[model samples]
Target: MTNIWEPIRIGRMNLPHRFAMAPLTRSRAQADGTPGELAAEYYGQRASLGLLISEGTQPSADGQGYPNTPGIYTDDHVRGWQRVTSAVHARGGHLFIQLMHAGRMGHPDNTAHGRAPVAPSAIAPGEKMFTLGGLKDAPVPRPLATEEVPATIADYRHAAARSIEAGADGVEIHGANGYLIQQFFSPNANTRTDSYGGSIENRARFGLEVVAAVVDEVGADRTGIRLSPGSRLGGIAEGEGHEAFYLHLVKELARFDLAYLHVAHGGNEELLRRIRELWPKALLVNRVNRPLEAATADVEAGLADVAPVGRWALSNPDFIERFRRGAALNPPDPQTFYGSGAAGYTDYPHLEASAASA
Candidate 1:
């Protein structure tokens, strides 16, 4: 049995333990798409998590979907992230910045681009998004012209370079969560008749190309990707052939010899087993809505190399210490989960604070 505390190597970096801080969106960035000043403190406080994956960062202005989410495509963005990465490194932690393009999930009101969102097709996701102006229904996105696909892929490569320049250990391409990459995986979200649509292989083309581009710009050892095989987030349906689609996608992704494959799993047992068999490198699994007991059990049973925790890590920056000590965890406040303040961001009580208060 593999104990979660044992050291493991994922790509070029070596971690002291297996409990990683999952990527989370806190909506706490500057208006110009730079990370908020408090962002450094927030992340630095959680450096004990060993491997902290930063929140989803937009690769371009068009990638902005929610208000105040950070970007990695500009000089200001790079400088802002430098503070974050430096803080994490000073405490001997590794950070992987996740690059996410919202695609149809984007709204013009939230971004300076002030244009309709883009997707594999011109379909609307029929979801409401909160913006600086107010909440609004997602607008039907503009279909990317065939020629524009290459440029879009280039954005990932550029962002990967920017993440590296900002001193991150690696980059994780956000291929999960009904984002641009997952939009291409859905039959309803993507109806293109070109090379980017019609078949599973074609639909996988854009994401794989984006991954390849990022790998070329930043070595494979410094690149990773997250995928949700059966996620229905953002109203996405993976179609009848989803199982086959994911199997093929996993097999294709294994060729890169990348850092690790992060799976935001939602109870797709057989497919996950297949992925485990096919994937050759590190596998980080985040079981949606599962408790720490279950997560650790998965690692103990050889199900995943690492278990990334979201809210637990959020509400308890000293989560690793508490877990090691078998102490209590601070309950996460849903109200402050997406707000821009220190109330729930970095103000969570650690074991020492809790004991002192008692």
Candidate 2:
């Protein structure tokens, strides 16, 4: 039997297979940051995957940077997400909500309160994010004061608790993709002199604190963190010789005994082997274009405990069985990705072998 199809334990849950769905932002939520009506059907369609990580959701109003992205801070957001979890569980899928704060990667026209973005330092991301008006330059976010830093971290803790309350199995802290936590990790973005800056340890403080807080709210066994060690997205540049930075970060994070440490842009065999040695927990590996062959290879090589696929899962409702049988997949229409209706959301075709029969 292929180990790819074997059962494995992640935290208290035993997954029937090693394939998981990575979080992908579709920006299809309500304008007020509430989960839209189609979300339950969208997620429920792909519930054949063992695990599904939802899109990056803001923990607070200030944390939001993209239009139509969901939030977990408000009562409405929690109730909206409950529908998704219930729908997924009905099909025997485990779900985790990824808490993402976009930091300085925001424009005023995108947020409801129209507030300036916040970050580890008062730096601009040297790029633009989509706003209601149009694409515009990202503003220089206000530097978080030392006294107020704890509150920012607490926001993540509150969101984690809310996720479990919403019936999610766990939470994944979004410490990647040039977001709030990743902003601090990048020297190009974090220029603070306080304890949360300067050395690698200091720069990693905010991320560690956020993770610790979430772990406290949810148990360590039910928590996870995602990182993209080499990704320079949104003008985020980690300083030279920062391989040591992630090495140290992963080693320290290993002490928490979390369920998993997910890595984006960590797919190379050598790099994966090195990090796998340091992380004592399950390694959920994902990066763009993680093909079925590569995923099978990594799992067989023991470099990854699970391979999380994102966009492919977006278009194919029966992704698991299709991959298992080496069948063709449905191509996603880019135009309908963020649209209001179900044109490309829930109407995608599933295999005839699937229960839905497309």
Name the best candidate (by TM-score). Answer: 1
Looking at model 1, how many pairs of residues clash? 0
lDDT of 2 by residue, 110-215 (tens): 8879889999999898897887678899988889999999999999999999999999999999999889998889899988999999899999899998888998
Instruction: Score candidate 1 by lDDT.
Output: 0.92
**Candidate 1 lDDT tens digits, 171-269:** 999999999999998888899999999899999999999999999999999999999987888879997689999899989999999999999998988
Model 1 stretches with alpha carbons more than 4 Å out:
none
Error of 1 at 233 (Å): 0.7
**Against the unseen true structure, what C-alpha lDDT does each candidate score?**
0.92, 0.87
Top lDDT model:
1
What are the TM-scores, per candidate, against the unseen true structure?
0.99, 0.96
TM-score of 1: 0.99
- The deviation in Å at residue 17 for candidate 1 is 0.8
Worst 10 residues of 2 by lDDT: 265-274
Stretches > 4 Å off in candidate 2? 266-269, 353-358
